[model samples]
Target: MKPLLVVFVFLFLWDPVLAEMHKKCYKNGICRLECYESEMLVAYCMFQLECCVKGNPAP
Candidate 1:
């Protein structure tokens, strides 16, 4: 029971950190493109953008 409680607590705390990281990276990519920066420098950003867009579709 103690281990299960620890696991649940870890998950609850982990999600927000992951989400914040994702948002930061996403915004960084958008800023790079908006400033007309080179794609080669932020190529990973392109992939991230595509993945998020595809993962979440309009209702």
Candidate 2:
């Protein structure tokens, strides 16, 4: 019973916003105001931001 209680407490303390600044973008890229010339937009982020990844240089 004590082990089960500890597991439950650990689960309850887990936070979704621990990395709120770049929640959507992980090792792939980052969240920014806009994707620039050398970056590509992969997804949308909170507060009108964008998840961008490095891309090939523009010709």
Which regions in candidate 2 have their CA more than 4 angstroms from the true location? 1-27, 57-59
Which sections of candidate 1 miss by over 4 Å?
A: 25-59
Residue lDDT tens for model 1, 1-59: 99999999999987765554355344244322222212322323432332122122234
- On TM-score, the candidate that comes out on top is 2
C-alpha root-mean-square deviation, each candidate? 10.8, 8.5
